[model samples]
Structure formats: structure tokens, C-alpha cells
Target: MELVSEHVANWTGVRLFQQALRAAGGHRFPALPAALPDANGGSLPADRAAVVLAELDAFAGTARITDEVELIDEATGRVLMQYVESYRGVFMFGPGFQAGVHPEGFFVLDRADPPVTLFRAARFGQRALPGDRVEFTVGGTRTVVAMRPVGEHGEPPPERLAVRTRSRSGGDFAYVVEPLRRLCAASVATGNPVMWC
Candidate 1:
């Protein structure tokens, strides 16, 4: 099944991925190193569910996990990731900010100044203002371009103007913003690098 644009075979892979993120909590960026367990054949650690549960409790904020059982299911990770994107108005590489060819890879949008700036703001604990701007090279000349108010009246926030909400069969998924915000906060608080699996 496809979760947030990536394909995963079963909920086992989702559980394993969540465990990896929890294990890498407080880890630094560009150095979030962890080995992924095989989705089909690999088994999770005996205490992994507890660890993830604790992590969720620690970072739950206002966005409580409506269904704890979903934590072990692939839909939870995918839904959470979608909420993060919808709330933050940014496109994550895979799940969160980290992106790679495989689920384990992490990346940053270095080429674009505005995205990098906004990413830094969300990664840290700053708000990206609507008046933000950065220098961009056009044709050969560098010009200052506006970064904020990206959408009409800035309704969709920053980089999320282009995000198309997915259609779930059971109406729309109930998504809250606090969970995603707190997830970013938890990452900064623990220095645990966030990634998408």
C-alpha cells in the first residue's frame, strides 16, 4: 500500500520505521544514521512498541493519537506524515523533512534559498513570516524575490500552496495541526533528527 507517496508492503514495515525514528531521537541532522529492518522478514525489537508509545506520549502535544493501535499500522505513519505536511505547509522528502532514494535517506533543499530558510525556521522554533524574501538568480542577474504569501492571500501558508489533499474513502481524514507542530518541537527539544520512512 502507498503511504504518503511511498509504498510499503505491510504494517510491520510501518512499525519498524516508527521504531527507527524513535531510536534516532536527539540525533543530529546529516548524521541520522540507523539500519532499517526488513519489512517482510524482519522483526521489531521486543520493547519497540513501548519505546514508540513513550515517545508518542512525550511528543503527543494536542494531537493525541486517536487510535493507539494505528501506531503499529502503516496508515498511522502515512496519515501522520500527511498531517505534518498539511499543517506546516511544506513538502517533506518522504515522511518529514528527511528524504532519500530509500526510506533511510535524509536530505535538505539546499538549492532554493527560501525553502532552506523556511525549513530552518520549522526545524528550529521560529515562525516564517509572510514578508520573507531571498535572492534568486534569473537569467544571470540576482534579484530579491518574495518568499512568503506564496498562495492567494497566503491561505495555504508557505510552500504548501501546491499540496493536493488526498481523497480518503471515509470522507476526509481528521487531521490536527498541533501534533505536527509538536513533532517538530520534540525533534528540536531532543535534538532527534526527524525523517520520513
Candidate 2:
């Protein structure tokens, strides 16, 4: 019974193969043809074969296939890579955002080891946004060519809240607006008048 089932499956596969050959042309060979026959019977469907071949073929012609890679930090689960091609168009967050304007459209490359953000410039268009899934190249170092917004736009929260500081010296001592966070305070100049204070 097992052998019979195996034979049945094999027959089904052969039938499918015959159907594919008939679809490509009309003739079917007795045994699986070494290669698909061409319209002129010179070689298998070069065009169709080219579509299936995987290894880099220098002779057939240049084909562009976009893909993605996840950039993850080995030390931390924190996603260090963004704009991976495999993710489709979703953008991943990196340890830090690039200060410069992201190019119009390009995929974000994520590195696995030691985690790094690299941008691919030429392969993008204007459709990519921050946090979008995108396909990109894996070879060579990646560089940012363009970028798109990742999610809905919203006002960023203030880094610090203003507070009143009193000078010990004397006088009425007008209320000084001090930042809630030391880092925020550093960004404010000493003399800048704080409206909230």
C-alpha cells in the first residue's frame, strides 16, 4: 500500500510537469527533458530559466532583487537597524537617529554583529518613510540615501518643564525658568528669559 501511494504521488508530479511543458509549448518528451525546449528547440526557455536561476549569473543579464536584513544589537535586543528590505516597508529603530534629512527613498540596512545603521541611497525613491518596511541590498556598507516618515505625525513632548529658580544674592529676584531635566537646562542659555517662569 505504501509503495502504491508513493507511485501515485510520483505520477501526479509527472502530470504536473507535463502540464507545465504543455503550457510553455505543445510538445512533451518521454523522459524529463534535460532542459526545457525553446520555441526553436535550441535550449530550454532561457527567459523562463533565467527567472528561476538563483546564483549570481553574470552572463544572463542583470536582475535587481530587493531584500531586507534585520539589524539587531548583540548586547541589547534594542533594534539598531532600520529600513530592512525583508520587513517589506517597515522601518526599524536604531540606537540614534541621523541628524541629516533622510533621502527621498532608500532602504535602511541593519547590521547583525555589533549593530550599525547603514543607508543605501541609489536604490530608493520617494515612497520610503521612517519605520517603513523596505527591501535593500546586502553587499558593501549601507548609507542613507533617502528616508520616509515611519508613523503618524505628532508633537514631540517637551524635554523639560520650566521651573522658577531664586538667586541667593538679593533683589526681588524675578522667577527664572529652570529646566526640569539637566540636559534640557543645558540647551537653554543662561540669559534666555523663560516665559513660564
Global CA lDDT computed for model 1: 0.29
lDDT (C-alpha, whole model) for all candidates: 0.29, 0.27
lDDT of 1 by residue, 81-190 (tens): 22221113233332222221112111224334343531221111112444664332323443343443222242333221111233221111113223333443444545
Model 1, 44: alpha-carbon shift in Å?
A: 1.5
**Residue-wise lDDT of candidate 2 within 1-197, one digit each (tens)?**
01111111232223323333333333322222233221222422333333222211221122221222223222333333333222342344444433111223333444456534465342222223256432233345323433333221353212211111111211111111011122113223332221210
For each of the candidates, the C-alpha root-mean-square deviation to the true structure, in angstroms, is 16.4, 31.7
TM-score of 2: 0.16
Instruction: Find the 10 residues in a row with the least total lDDT in model 1.
Output: 67-76
lDDT of 1 at 39: 31
Candidate 2 positional error at 175, Å: 15
Listed in order, each prediction's TM-score against the native is 0.21, 0.16
Mark the regions of model 1 whose C-alpha exceeds 4 Å error after superposition.
Answer: 1-38, 62-197
Measured by TM-score, the strongest candidate is 1
